[model samples]
Every structure is written in structure tokens, then in C-alpha cells.
Target: MRVYVAKSGDSLLKISETHKIDLNKLLIVNPHISSPMMNITGSKVYFPSSPISDTLQTPISECPLPSPSDLLSSWIPLTSLEQMADTDYDVLIVGSGAGGGSVLRRLAEQWLNSGKKVGMIEAGSLLLPTHVRNIPTVNDTRFSQYFHTVSKWTGKYLPDFPGARQLFALGGRTLFWGMSAPRMDDSEFFDWPMPLKEMKYYYNIAEKIMRVSTAYMEGSSIQEILLKRLHENGFPEARDVPTPADLEVTKYGQIHSDVFWSSISALAYALNRMPFDLAVNARAVEVIVEQNEVVGIRVMSPNKRAYVLKAKTIVLSGSTFETPRLLLHSGIKGRAIGHYLTNHSLLLATAKVSRQQFPEVLGTLSIFIPQTKKHLYQIQMGGPGGEDQWYLWYSQYEEKALLDELLIGISAFGKVESRFENYITLDPNKQDKYGVPKINVNFSYSKQDTEIIHQMAAALNQVSSAMQAPLIVPNNRQAICLMPPGGDYHEVGTCRMGDDPHTSVTNRYGQVHGVAGLYVADNSVFPSMGAANPTLTTVALSIRTADYIVNQLK
Candidate 1:
């Protein structure tokens, strides 16, 4: 067998044409080659000893291709706690959510060619196929099974507020995110530490990598009606939703269908194909700091074994709650470490869409409604409210009769002003099973938040009236239903970024204010939580931070 090193832009077709071997033969020999157009750069390809007949025919039943699991299993081997502790790494990332996953991919791609080692520690176990393949509802038991054990809040300030849901799997909460990736408007970035231009550049990079689709409201009839209504009301900023999915294109060049949105699990699977190390079920206990600098991290394995892994740089991408808990447990002190905790106030209002008027609109379509003088909100048409047959039966309506009654829901995410009172602190007397400090969360909405919710309710009522669709009132509410704080799961502003070290925990580049070689790349570092969802912005910020770290290392 002859070995051929695949270069950049090398494809199986090109290799077959160059070597004068049949495509089927090439695929048969290299079972790992899933697709002909797949880029196998920096890898070795094996050729047969002699070229077979040009007309060689292989039986379809005889040829077996590798499954996604097979391919993923062969990508990278999971490192054991002992193995990880034995070697020092150039960069160590904690958490594998969108922020940490993006940073790891960016840095690993740049450092892979240089032979620099990059390590990632995930507190949760590896995500199983059952977790990724199923789309369970929020109330489903499977949903709870994927989260961390300590996913609830305990504190005096806990109001009727919704409890925090923490997912500690390979991709964190991103494995079950709504996949709404909207760019923050200019007004929303007023409180951001960096300039909008710099942030926009990183947003472009993140959108490109995540495959955020641009064709938003092309085929949805509900979106068309909403756009017309917004235009008639002089709100032109209400545009099609930007999601991380590829739209299905037709033969006539019209894009109409919606695909599954991108997730961090897919990104992690791709990154695992590269040269990197990932340790799962390894909970980070503390940062091994020496002389005011981070040198390593202490982690406990699943079997109660502890290990200390050395690294030149440590990045904390744990969620807002866990990140602050880790820092506080490590004896890192800052007034802003766990202060300014904020999440958007979620208000959901639903109305039945006239299916007779638009029978073609079947799936959901998201639209952003930016308020010039108030909080920005999002409107989604054809949600999951009126889809289930069991729900129709329980509501005393036949499923066949409700075929023309699609549910259109609007979500208004009010901008909750970050306050010092809404914060998370480590419980002095409590500890989790892993011997880590338990977190006590204290968060509540302000008066302004209430005002924004009222405004959003009023706007939703106007839209429902304009559409001539009656509101779906389940709880006998006069207006919209206001969900508790943290309902959106868009918590941020804990470890805020600012120019002043005393007021913020991290700088503009996400590096720690007083601690060297320590950085934060998750929503915990957000200075402000705009009405927009935090996933896209968190990813963009993480990419920028990764670029900065690469430059600093160089």
C-alpha cells in the first residue's frame, strides 16, 4: 500500500483523479471517508497495491460505511484523569459549552499545526446518542437527566423566580438550547466594554463557523403577516430570525424549509477529529494559584480520585453560577465576581393563527421586534403549543378540527438591569457530593423590568388584535403570562468586563483583572444582558478572547 498525505483542500474525488483509481475503490479502502467532498487535510490516505479495472463494480450490499458514532469514536480518545495529570498543557479550558467550545476550536486549530497541546475538562459525562438524537420537551424526564446534580437554587432572596438549570454534559446547555442566534442591536451594546465594530467582526466569524442562516422569513406565512403589521406600524427593524441552520433549497432556487440548528455538540464532534485532548466526568474543584498567577487546576474524577493538571493558561467557561462558585472557592475575591447577576424577564403570549388564511405555514418562524423606547422582544409563529394530539383531546377539541388552528406565540425578553442585590454567593456551610461549595443565588426583577413586561404585553395584545386572532388563555389571565426570572436561561453579568479592575473581574479581552494566565469566556463575563439571547454574543466574545490568547502566546 502507498501512503498519500492529504493537503489543504484535498478531496477524495481529486485524489482519485490524481491517482487514477476509481472513486468506489477509494471509498472502499478508506472506510473512514464518509463523503467524497469531505476535507481530509493533515491526514494520511492509503492506496491499493495495484490499480483495479476502471470498470470494476462493487456490490452495494458488500460496501459498508462507518456510522456517525463509529466516526466520532475514532476521532479522539478520551483522556483518563491520570493521563491528563501526567502531561502539562499549553492551554486548558474548563467547560465545553458554546463559549468554551468555540475558544477550544479556535485555539486548537491554530495550535494543532504547531504541536501545542490543548486540553478541555468537562464536569459532566459524555453526551450519549440518545441525548443528541431526541427532542424532548422541557418538562420531560429526559431533560432533567442531562443536567448537573446541583441544578437548583437555595437562598433567602429566592422569590417565585425560576430555578437555575445547569447542564454539565460535553456541550453544556447548548445541547438543548433553543438555537436562537440573533445579533445584538447597536442600542443593546451601549453598556458593552468594547466597541461595536470590534464585536461585529467577531460576530461574523462566529456566525460563519456556526452556519447561521441568513434566509429567515422566506416561506412562512405567519412571518409575512407579522412583517406587514410591523411595517404598517412603522417598525421596520422587525426582520427575519437569524438561526444557525441551513435552509433547504429547491430546484427553482427558492429556499423555504428549515433545517436543524447548529449546536456545540456538533462543533465538539468536529474538534475531536483534530489533535486535542478532552477529559469528561472530571469536575474542576479549584484553581492552583501561586504568586497571584494561575498555574494549574485541581480536578476530581468520577470515582472520587483527585488529580492536579498543570497548564500555562486557564480559562473558566463554566456557566454564570458555576464560574463564580469556582472563583470564590479558589479564594479569588472581587466585589463584581458574583454581583450584577441578571437574566431577561420572559413574557409569553399565544394566539391561534388562522390556518385557513395561510394553510402553507406549518412550522415556526421567529421575528425580532426592537422597541425604540422600550425593551426588545421576539415573536414566534406556529410554536409547539397547538401541535400535540393529546393536548387537543384534553382541551375538548378534536385534532382534526384544530388542523386550521396553529398556535403563534410571542416572547418578550425584558432587559433586566443588573443590580448588586441580584448575586450568587458560595454557601459557607454546604457542599456538593464532589466536595465543591454549593451556590446560593439571589436574583429578582426591578421596577423597570416590570414596566418593560407591561409594555411588551400591550404590544402583543395589539399584534393579536391586528391579526384578528383570539388569545389562548390557559390560566385565565387577562394579559400575557410573565415567567419568573432566569426563565429564559440567559443569565449573565456576573463577572463583568470593564476598564476598571476594582469594579469588574475581567478586562475587555476577558482576562482576569488581577490574576495573570486566568481568563473567563462564558456568559459570566458579560457586562450587560441585552434583550437578545446570550449564546451568539457569548460565542463571538469567546472567539475574540481566543484570538487574543493566541497572539499573547505567540
Candidate 2:
């Protein structure tokens, strides 16, 4: 194969795939390649005839980084373009969400240090501007209105507030995440297809990189009383768990923040300064495959211009919902593509409390209850009483102090079995402006879900009574704002990873069974949705993918 040079918006995975060449072989021919740190649009690279699949099957002992000379040689003017040259890179990463973001951070530090050209591709606009937190309220319209909806390339609309917000902006969904960074229990990780030990280590590494912190802040009187009551009610260990941000201050005395709103944050925090080709406003249209192996992808820019990219290896970091949609569009029909979908439900209960009782509650705190083996419950943090009305349900408590400052919010996540009824399909009759099918998500809760939430609420009320914060559990219909199928926005398990190729889309190592050099490292690979936030786990799996890619490259 001839050497190829990447031009404007070119990706390595798209190129090698175009010629049916192995990604490792292509990189072998051109050993000195730039990392995502550089945007080497005019850099030259070699293409080899042998398939990387054969050579890369054997695991390498260590991951190597590119040399300084290689980095210099691969440096192309950020503005330069030379599209038609043949060059090979060790790996190519797609998407810049939790999965892609974590891998790129690791790869840039390790493999890229060995002087290997690594190409990272992103197909959404950079919604976040530099120096975001300094801009006042976190609820600023820039983040709430524009950044939220603009990232979506689905070309279809969902319910306004919560649904339409899952856009494809620069940091992906990380920008608006509640920053809840809970660790997955051993049972959660052990149940996965891959070994649990390595996964736990990876989770730790990812948490460090993301600067995840634990929850902190003074607990409200209600929280204190509730815990005491739970103890009295035979559940003493159940208490509120802090968020990553809260924990940083509480546990480590650190006030670290997150780096998810921008791709730049992911690279910059790692202290990396390489030029990488990060194309914004570009949407991946299809996955191009030949001989049953993924080669590259077709992308459409905001201008409606279509471009084809070839790469030796392709990793899909799109979220759970979109990942399956992409695979199905590319014709990789697996039963697991859009099955076993799970998202935590938030059930809001209202009550009236005295204003004097509202002084203590600070941040989002939660009390977890592991009910039975499969069923679990959580009573989230809140204030006074009627405050739940704007968010959950209205209140009519009489006391002046009680009725005025009453606000509460709580959510419970119940693990549900994968059912055929809960699925995703392209609305054949509808299409976005870009002509992609409008995604129609059909999701509802089982009776078990309802039972758990009601039970959780009863427990919460008992606890609140100890603190003088009584709650009125409304009918399910009235609590619509708090508990919905996709309330917490934690969606997972669309394209699961497993040992059985016949039943799974990706293997334990995240590699697509039939497709060489193609892997998915996102919530899409989750087989069973554990009763916790999915971001940290997604980060861990992505890091694992990075390690796997590094091994194969070596």
C-alpha cells in the first residue's frame, strides 16, 4: 500500500479502512506519527500491504510513546491541508465523550509518547468556550439552552426540557452532567464479561484523571433526623453518599472540578500540547466496512458536505442510544444493538416544613438502601417542603417558616431486566433535516420499579419524621416530574459486551468480534445496568479500551 497524507478533517481509521489494510500494518510502515496533540493535516505516512490483524493479535508487553523527533516531523500547520497522501497511524479514536475522552488522555500520555501517530476524531461543535465556570451561574442559558440542543445530530427533537438536551456538543454529555461520581461495587464490575480486578484499577485511574470528588457539605436537620430514624427503623447503615465534588472537599480537603465540557479540557489537564484534528460541527453518517471489518466512516459537516475517512482501527464512543443506532445503520445487526436499556428513575415526594428547618441542606446528598438482591432504593436530598413543587410537587403547609422555603428532590434507581419492549428504532416515517432517521425510544417501567420507589418514599418519610420533615407521597401521576422512564438521564446497555459473539456485539476487550480493529467503549457496551451512575464505569471501560489498543499497537 502507498503512503497517504491526511488532509483537512481526515482520520486515520477512515483511510486504512478504505484500502482494506490492517491498522497496525499501516502504522508500522510509518512509525513516526503525531499524536492527537497535533493537527498534522499535511503530514506524510506510509501504508503497508500486510494486515495488522495478524501481527496485533499477540499482545505487546508495553505501550510506547512517540519520540520528540517524530512529533516534530509530524507537525503540520493547523491551517495546512494535503488530503490525498497516504499515511498510517497506530490507532484512530472517534467521539470525544466519556469513553473517547478518557482513552485519548491515556493514549496521548503513553502510546503517543512512543512517537506513534494517533488520530482522534470528534463530530460535534465545541459548545463550551474557554473559561466557562468564571461566567456566573451554572444554569446560564449558554449551557442550558444552546449547548444542550446544538450538539445533537440526530436531526430529531424530543420533549423539550429533559429529552431534547442530550446533544452532541464538544464535551459530549459531560458538560451538563450532575458530576455524580460514584464507584461501581465489586459485584457490579465482576458481573461484567471482562475480569473485575483490572476494571477496578482502571476505574480508579479514570476517576483521578476526571478529578472526581466525593460529596460534602452540611446535612440538613431533616437528613440527620431521617438517618437516625432509619437506624431506629432497622436500617442504620443507610446514609447519604456525597458527590465527587462534595467528596473532594470532605474527604481529601480538595476542591477539584471536572474537565468534561470540552475536548480541550480532556487533553489540557493531562498537560498535553499536541496538535490534534478535532473537527466540530461534523456528524458521522455511516460506518464503512469491507470484508466484514470496519475501515472508516462517512461524515457530513455542518455545511452538508460529505467526506469519507479511512482508518485502521475505529472506536465508537457514542453514548448508549446513538452507538446502537450507528451500528444498525452500518448493518451490523446484532440482537443486542438496542436491547437491555436502563436509566435511573427519580421519584419526587412533597411535604411542608418550617423555614427554620431549611438552613442546613446544601448540596445533593443521598441515602442508599439495597433492598433484596435485585431491588434497591435511594432517598435523595432536599429542603423544607413545598420547594418540591417547582420541581416535584406543590405544598400547602401552614407555618410561615415552613411553607416559604420548603424544597426537596430525591431519586431512586431500580435495576430492570432487559426487555424486548424497551427498545430503540428509527422512526421510518420521520427524518431529521440531515435525513437521518428520527430515533424513537420506546421505554416504560415495570411494576417492580414502581414498588421500589414507593417503598423508598415510605422509608424516607419515616426518616423525615424524626427531623420534623413530613412528606406526602403523591399518586404516581402527580409525581411525573420526579420519576420518569429517563428521569435521571443515566441510559445504558444498548450494545453490550460479552464473551458470546453470537449474543454480543463487542467482546470482553471491547473489540467487535467480526470486525477487526473496530471497538466500542461507552455505555453502549454495558451488559447489565448496575444501580449507580454510569459515567464512572464508562470512563473505566474507555481506559481499558485505551490499554487494549496500546497493547495491540505494540
* Clash count in backbone of candidate 2: 55
* All candidates: TM-score: 0.78, 0.71
Q: What TM-score would you give candidate 2 relative to the actual structure?
A: 0.71
What is each predicted model's overall lDDT from 0 to 1?
0.74, 0.61
Best by lDDT: 1
For residues 10-71, could you state the per-residue lDDT of candidate 1 as single tens digits?
Answer: 98988998878778878877888899888899778877655453336534466788887555
lDDT of 2 by residue, 1-554 (tens): 56677777655565666667666665666667644234557778676644555566677787788877455322122211124113354566668777887777777777544766556556665555432432334323344454444545332344321342365655677666655566655666566787777877887787677655433324445556556666786666565653443123224664334322333456554435444455555677688889987777776767677766667778888787778877877787677677666666566655445556434442223454443344464444433234222321111231223245455544555555555566787778876556677677777778876676666656665655644555554554453244445656677877778888766778898988788888898887887765667787888888888888888877
- Check candidate 1 and list the clashing pairs: none
Candidate 1 minimal-lDDT segment of 10 residues? 389-398
Q: Which residue segments of model 1 deviate by more than 4 Å? A: 1-76, 128-161, 248-273, 359-363, 371-402, 475-479
